[model samples]
Target: MKRLLKQSILVLAMAGMAGCTTLGPDYQPPEVDVPQQWQSSLTEASTVADREWWKLFQDPVLDELIQQALENNRDLRIAAARILEYAARVDIARAGLYPNLGYGADVARTQSSRNTLGAPPDGVGRVGSNYHAALSVGWELDFWGRIQRSTEAARANLLAEEYGRRALVLSLVSSVATAYIELLSLDRQLEIARDTLKRRAENVDLFRVQFEGGVVSELEVAQARAEYETTAILIPAIEQQISITEYNLSLLLGRNPGPVARHASIAQLVLPQVPGDIPSQVLLQRPDILQAEQDLVAANALIGVARAAYFPSISLTGLLGLASAQLSTLLEGASGIWNAGAALAGPIFSGGELDARLRVSEAVQQQLLQKYLVTIQRAFSEVDKALISSQKLREVLAASQRQVKALKDYNKYARERYDEGYVSYIEVLDAERRLFDAELEYTRRQGNSYVALVAIYRAMGGSWVDAAEAVADKVDFPPQDAPESRHWWEYPPATRPAAQNQP
Candidate 1:
């Protein structure tokens, strides 16, 4: 009997080792044709993609704000948690490759009535007790590579989630910087409004006095008051916009709606040097593209899993234990008992269910493949758009600066002519109005130029992400080596009451 058991175990091991080849298509990364260089014209600016691009702005407050948002942002937190969730799923899928070992004990007492015709003879007591203890092992042999495929799919999903989280980090940093720039530009606009209001108020007092003394007409006083009112109304409008922007920025920092601290005016913020000579192929390395590719990998692996469902599932189960009527004799050799068995279960008929499932998996793979391609295309498109915006907005900023300067000179000349009685105050008001609009536009152009730079960095992903991550929040995975600390899922279903309540 012992030799037979050994032979049986040997035969089963050989069968498992000789399982058929893995099913379904193996994943090979799809090659995408890329332009040798970006379509946008290249510049001689120093490359900033290899370093922390935000620090190029040289604003300490901006740096601190980005760090805070990275650490506290709810979107980033959700993405990080998704990585942990997928990692657990990978472990669960991998466990199918190993046997499950468990121990069980049972104690029972029974009484048979003597009045029953089928009762045991009087040699045995009417009431008796039996005790049994056993160790059991069950393992599903991977004859069709189902478990391997499932594990492969799960691991790919884990990687996809990790990349997704990284993509979120990249987006988070960009958003914070953009919002900060906008807030600073609004601040500059408000400053300009207040200064203009003060100047207009002084003019109103002067024109009213001149009109009372018969040196100027009442029309001049009315025009001065009208200009003063215009500038006065603008202050509150800019102030309201500032408040709204502050509220949006505060949300990014994961804080309550409130004012955001600034370290410099919009004009004072340094313009980051554009990264030059970028190859279009670099878009493949963007976190979103990588994440999409991993999703494709996972989908491809699922085809194998679904295909394997058509084959028979083979498993080995064994038990070795002690059983006896007497507690003290349970440890004796005579009480020893053991059994080994093999099971083969396959779908005899599923009413087209298995076929439909396989079709579904195949369709999903096709969908993901298209999605991956779209992601790559979109990545390249974004880079192109960002580069163009950066270049064109720089030109806009230059022109706006020149316009502001010309308007400033025009305002001065118009005021002099009015004082010399060569022109009406209406010319002065028109020049001042044009100058005020130009000033606001110039400030807005400054902010947009900086924002375009941020967009460029975001679109052309590179090592700067690692540099940013060095200062951002850190997510720690659960320690796998700590045997004493068990996850709720590790507990048996009957023993884990808390698992039912877990999310």
Candidate 2:
């Protein structure tokens, strides 16, 4: 019997090795077409985008705000929590690859009536006591690789969640920067409006004095008053917007509605030079794209797990124990008991449930494959759009600066001509109105330009928070120097190269 048990153990070991083969298609990333160069002809300078892109702005207030958002934002915290949850799931899936063991013990006493069977004349009842202790083990042989495939799927899911968290961080950084820029822009706008209103108020006084001196008509004074009131009205409107923007920014920082501190005005902020000559391949580093691919990987692995169900599932169970009627004999060799066995189960008929599951897994994998492709395409589109917006907005901002300069001179000359009685009050009014509009537009353009820059940084998958350092210490907001020119391929291999070039 001992020899038979050894032979059975050897057979099971051989069977396990034979069953180690994996089923279903191995994962291959779907191919995408990448452009060699962007359609727009932006300069091909080396991209410092890989560094914390926000550091390129060199603004201390913005740096601090982004850091706070990274630490305090609720959505970001949820994403981090999900990573832990998936990590635990990976552990659970991995546990299936090993045997489970348990220990148990029991002591019991029983009484039986003597008349129930072969009763003794002198005995009224019978009493017995029992003791038992056992160690039990069970394991399912992964001959069809179901457990391994499940583990693979879980690991891929964990990676996907990790990428998802990174993507959220990227988005959170962009959001905080965008909100901060808007706040500054609104502040600048409010300043311009107040300054224009002051000038209008002074002009109203000047027109009233001229009317009193019989040099100007009452109509002129009335028109000046109207202009002053119009400019005054803008103050409340802009102030309202500023309040709303601040509230929004506070939420981004995971704080209650309150004033946000700032040191730099919109004009004080300088736009960083665009990362010249970004290769089309850089979109692969985008966290969303990486996350999508990981999802696809998980889906693909599930297909194998589902396919594995079509084969027989083999399990081994064993129990070793001591059992005795008297507790004193429980540890003796004569009281020892043990049993071992194996089981094989296969679906003889399951109303097509197994087939349906396999189909479902395959369908899900195909869907994820499509989604992965879409993610890559969308990432490329965003980069293209950001590049175009940056280039065009730069031109617009330059024109706006020139327009503001020209209007400044025009307003001056118009006021002088009015003083010399060379032009009507209407001419002065026209110049002032035009100048006011141009100043607001210039401020708005500045803000838009900054916003576009933020968008580009987001599109490029730049990281402001260092993963390792973020965990160990408070984030530092040091200014970043431009990196040397390097090939885009030097970025991390989160994604594979596109199979075809864009036309």
Candidate 3:
């Protein structure tokens, strides 16, 4: 019997190896067109996007805020937890490739009457007891690679989730930097409003005195007061905007709505360098694009799973244990028992359910393929848009600077003409109004230039994102609701401790 059992096992192993044939299409990355060079380029600045580009601003406060956001942001935490979820699912899918072993034991007593339809002989009274115990195993042979295909799809999903986390980190870093720049801009605007208001107040005082001395008319005093009130109104509005920006930035840092620290003024922050030599193919490394492709890979593998379902499923089951009717002889060697068998099941007719499933899988594959292609196209478009904006915004800022300088000189000359009795006070008020508006506009464009730089770095992802994520990983986030007690299957010897929290 032992020899026969060994021969049966050997034949099953040989048949499984010989008949293995994976079904459906294998995954291949989709190819899409890429441009040779960006349409708008900045050739003068060094390539800062290859590394921690946010540090180019040289603001320690900005750096600290970004680090804080990376560690505490809720979105990032959710993404990390999703990665763990997918990892567990991968293990669940791979489990089908191995045998499922279980144990069972039971004891029962029964009483029978002679008058029953079926009864024991008269010599045997009516009461009886039975005991049984067994170690059983059931395994499905992968002749058509259904389990392999399912495992493949699960692994791809795990990769996609990992990339999704990295993409969130990239976005978080850029968002913190952009918000900081905006805060500085608002600060500068508030300063401009206050300074204009102070100067206008002095004008109102002087014009009133001249009117009382009969050197100026009441109309001139009224005009001066009107200008003063206009400038005064701007101060509260600018202050309100500053408060709103601070509260929003505080939220981005994953803190309660409150003030955010500022290390440098708008003019003090260094501008980030825009890298011009980026190749079009480098966009493939963007985490969002990579995540989308992984989704496509998983979808492609599901088609194989659907196709494999059409073939026959062969399973082997075995039981080896003891059974006895007498309680005293339950464990005796004579009571030992064993059994083994094979089963084959296949679809005969499912009312078109199998056909519909296959069609659905194929349709999902097509949808993900289109999404993958569209992601690449969007990445290219973003890079081009950021590059063009960065280059043109610099020109806009420079022109605004020139406008402010020209308006300052105009205000100075107009004031001199008014004091020398060569022009009316209206001319000086016009000059000052223009200068105030021009200064505010220049500050706004200055802030936008920095924001454009952030956009370019974000659009052109590279090794820098990995470096940022490394910093984020240093903070050991709590396990996502996973129990501290772990099963043997959850703590596989093949996986590293750093891979998951098994216990």
- State in Å the error of residue 51, model 1: 1.2
lDDT per residue (tens digit) for residues 1-503 in model 3: 35544655665566556667888899887778888888775766676677888888899999999999987787877776776677689889989887787899999998988887888888987988899988777889988889989988988888787778878888989988988999899899989988888888888898889899999999899889998998888888888888888887787777899988899899999986677777788889999998898899889999999999899999988777789999799889877778888999999999999999999999999999999999998999999999999999998999999999999999999999999999998999899999999999999999999999899989988878878886666552336566776443233222326645221
The whole-model lDDT of each prediction reads 0.83, 0.79, 0.84
What lDDT does candidate 1 reach at residue 456? 91
Q: Residue 465 of candidate 2: its Cα lDDT?
A: 33
Q: Which is the leading candidate under lDDT?
A: 3
Residues forming the 10-long window of minimal summed lDDT in candidate 1 = 488-497
Q: Indicate the worst ten consecutive residues by lDDT in candidate 2.
A: 471-480
Error of 3 at 296 (Å): 0.6
State the lDDT at 15 in candidate 1: 60
lDDT tens per residue, model 1, 1-503 = 35544665675567667746689999998878777877788574677776788998999999999988877777766765676577679789989887787899999999989888999897978998999998777889887788999988887787787677778878988999999999999999999999999999999999888988999999989999999998999899989998998999899887999999999988788997888766666678888998899899989999999999999998888877889999999989888888888899999899999999999999999999999999888888888888888999999999999999999999999999988999999999999999998998899899999999999999988867765654443432232443565454332212334635231
Off by over 4 Å in 3: 1-19, 476-503
